[model samples]
Target: MLIHGHEVPGAIDEETRCSHYHKENDRIAIKFHCCGKYYPCYKCHVEFGCGKKEVWPKAKFDEKAILCGSCGNELSVNQYFQSGYECPNCKAEFNPGCGLHRELYFET
Candidate 1:
């Protein structure tokens, strides 16, 4: 399926398949901890999926919460934050503006 102009591979397995979380220009995207799914942003999740948004516990910030769309590498929130939104393994550039919504999906 195509999401936000990106082709999604594999079958649509609700338990494991995440939505296309990257825009045409985005190199990476955030994954939803609530469902282990990825979306371009919180808006994308609300527009395409169901349920309340959930963030990883601050204590578990090191858990995987982002996806490197360029290389399919899953990154922990802490890693992404420290890298300034750059994918460590592939050096892909995620939209820096995403940080503005941190509080929406993260505990302060």
Candidate 2:
């Protein structure tokens, strides 16, 4: 699925929610560092992405790697971390549960 011109592989909705996670606030697509592809979640990436998975390196945190499904806002890793689980541009809430798997997408 494409949301705001960004391809979100394995997306189940326009909001970028996927089969593995479809909570109300689950509306973000992460750009995989491994393949430079966007996926709604790590599980989706595992299913439809390149076999190799790599967390976004801390050195590249300034790059825009997080896509806000609500307003199509492109956020850098550092901006997303400082956003408090919300879309800073649209003020939409993000699934805080995502923090549990932070290690999967970001260098920690």
Compared with the true structure, what per-residue lDDT tens digits does model 2 show for residues 1-108? 989899899998998999999999999999999999899999999999998878999999999999999999999999999999999999999999999999999999
User: lDDT tens string, model 1, 1-108?
Assistant: 443333333213322233543344355545666766666567666766456788777998988877666677777888888987677887767777678788877777
TM-score, each model? 0.71, 0.98
RMSD of each: 6.1, 0.6
Question: Where does candidate 1 stray beyond 4 Å?
Answer: 2-25
* Model 1 clash number: 0
Which candidate comes out best when scored by lDDT?
2
Note the Cα lDDT for every prediction shown.
Answer: 0.63, 0.95
Model 1 steric clash pairs: none
Specify the poorest-scoring 10-residue window by lDDT in model 1: 8-17
Model 2 misplacement above 4 A: none
